[model samples]
Target: MRLSKLFKNAPTVNITGLCLDSRKVKKGDMYFCLPGMTFDGHDFIPQAIEKGAIAIVHSKDIIDKLPGVIYIQVEDVTACMNQCARLFYSKPSDKMTMYGITGTNGKSSCANIIKYIRDLKEPCGYIGTIAIEYGKVRIAPDLTTPDTLFLQRKLSDMVRAGMKSCALEVSSHGLSQHRVDGIRFDVAIFTNLTYDHLDFHGTIENYFEAKSILFKELVKEDGVSILNIDDDRYEDLKECSKARVVSYGIDQNCDYRAINIHENAKSTSFDLVYKGQKYPVKTSLVARYNVYNLLACIAALHETGMSLPVILQSCTKIPQIDGRMEQIECGQPFHVVVDFAHTPDGMEQMLRYGRQVAADKGRVITVFGSAGKRDIAKRKVFGELADKYADLIILTEDDPRDENPKDIANQIKEGIQNKPNLFVEDRYEAIRQAIDNASKGDVVLILGKGDEPFMYHESGRVPWTGDNICALECLKASGYGENNNS
Candidate 1:
């Protein structure tokens, strides 16, 4: 690609690549000096040039002239880099049908469901919290929604690999920072709005407003906007969107409605009502929230030219999403579920369903904690919800980045009233204690950090196994391995 095509009134230069970090700059690469939350790329301009960056795109004015490097000043480096990335990638999102799912929860499950159904008919790509996968190429994710440059590059790769569709999990921080600015989505889904990320967003309304940006701008005019009518902000989202609206829920009048729902410990069955007809839908995924997720997937696929029968048939084949409500078994009499429920609403749903799964059999034991340096107000709320649902609670550490784990756990302990709770700072000890105390017919829920590979602390991320793996190890140590019938 030529530099003139990406920049305005610029000399012709062959642009080899685009880079944001100065350390990653290579020979003939164009480096972008953008300002971030903590570090300023402008301070590293000399390092970028030293690392063989041929062209420098910066926001600050430079009076000193380098020997052979080209310096292009811009009003905003972030916006300029975004445009340059789109040009370099040839706007690959335009060639494929893009589906974006955004909300406080269920984004990963819905995105994976869409990918699963689409992959049954044609090649598809997925970008979310779990992983980025397309055509046997799978990579760990750095963010729920990546930076604009990497996002465009990955979409271009998907296009080159002959993927017909793609599903993305759009986070509020990603939207507010314009990480997905250049891509136009064919379908936008709203799961629900709840209390989360208040430390960054300041309030719930600001968070919702940030999320509304996807429907208002990124979605094409003729695209479809699928929303959950059961959410309180459904009407607001409908009014904010310029695209055609397609609502899905169990309550209000929606384009897709799930009725006669039947949920068990293993599976859930519901009749999907569309227009004036009802279609039987059965899925291996449990819980009520997943019914909403399945409906959202069905609506998005239906709008994208998939038949109702095919969508229903695909629902039956949709496997369990990792770390959402994943069950781990080891020939034990009790049940163990590992989930990524961190927010207040998510905790409530997980506990409610956990209680249902353990009905008349045993007690519900919840093991969870709040993340450090996040919305501190939600800590007490999480404690309150755990007290309301679980028979026993164990508060453990969940990424106490810079704050003390004891302080974070104390805040959660303040909300519990006359409930049996234990404070354990070590996460491994907490999991072991929960499992060891559990009797036959008891359900143990290990929450917060689900499939994550590491534990964050002041010293930086340390190598750690996932919750499922740790629980299985504990069960094995207790003589509950596959061969043991006790």
Candidate 2:
């Protein structure tokens, strides 16, 4: 591409690519000097030039200019980068149907379901916590939402592969940083917002504003804004969004509502009330939270022009979402569920479900931990929820990166003032002990790290076998083999 096309008053040099990091700059690449909290990109100009970056885009004035390099000054490099990336990639999002989901939790599961439903009629891609995938390609994501340049490029690839739609998970950080600035969304879904990521956003209000960017700024004029009215933040979001609203929830008169809900150890059944009628819905997914996830997803699908019946049928065969209440049946007499409920609200809802699963016959044994350097205030809340919900609380390491695992566990323990709990430093050992102590009909709930493949510690992330596999192995060791139990 020509440099003149991306920026004004720039040299007509041929730009081969774009990059943000100086270390990754290649020959003919245009490196954008983006100032960040940790490191300023301007300081790395020499390195970027050395790494064959021919063009430099920065907001600050360069005191010492290097020869043979084209310099382009901008008022805002991040915004310019987003626009340039979109233009460079032919604005792929504009060429395809775009659906966005944002919240503290359920973003991944909702995105996956919307992608699956849309893909039924035409090819649709999915990008979120699990992985980015379209057709035969799947790439692990480094962030909830990738950098603007990488995201545009991926969407371009999806367009090239003939994908008709894309379901994306929008994060508050990504929105605040304008990562998805140039991309347009046709449908936006807001799952419930909870107390999480306070370390970054500083306050819940600021975080809510960041999430509001999607509905307030990104959704197209004619697009649909879907919200779970059951969520406490619904009124705030509804007031923020100018676009038409489509609501989904229970105990309220929503556009898409679920009523007559019932759940058991196997599945959940609900009557979905929409369009002045009620449709019987049954699914393998149990718990009220999942019903909320379902309502939000179906609303998006319906707004995207999918038939309600088809979407309901797809519900019957809902794909197993990784780490979101994923069950491990190793022929154990007791039940085991692994979930990615890291937030206080998420943990509370999941533990309630665990309690339901436990019923009168057993107890809910919970094993989870808090992340290092993330949110310190929420650890105690985790303990409080666990104490109220679980019978035995085994607090273990979740991702105590650069923070003492014992310290994190202790903070959580502070909340369990009267609960019978123990701090197990090693998570695998914690899982082993929890399973070893479980009796018949007990529901062992593994929280926090779901299907994640790595464990974070002071040494950073290392390869991990994940909780489901560890539970299966532990159950096998306890003489509960699938073959034998079946």
- lDDT against the true structure, each candidate: 0.91, 0.90
Which digits, one per residue and each the tens of the lDDT, describe model 1 over residues 1-486?
Answer: 888898878879888999999989988899999898899999998998898888999988888869788889999888888888988999888888899999999999999999999998889999999999999999999899999989999999999999999999999999999989888899999999999999999988899999999999855666999999999999999999989999999987789999999999889999988988989999988899999999999999999988889889988878877788988889888889999999988889999998998959699998998999999999999889888889999999999999999899899988888679998999988999999999888889999998888889999988778888889899998889767968
Error of 1 at 421 (Å): 0.9
Q: Among these predicted structures, which one has the highest lDDT?
A: 1
**TM-score for each predicted model, relative to the true structure:** 0.98, 0.98
- What shift in Å separates residue 460 of candidate 2 from its native position after superposition? 1.9
> Model 1: clashing residue pairs?
none
Clashes of 1: 0
lDDT for each residue of candidate 2 in 309-353, tens digit (9 for 90 to 100): 999988988877888889988788788989889999899988988
Stretches of candidate 2 exceeding 4 Å from the true structure: none
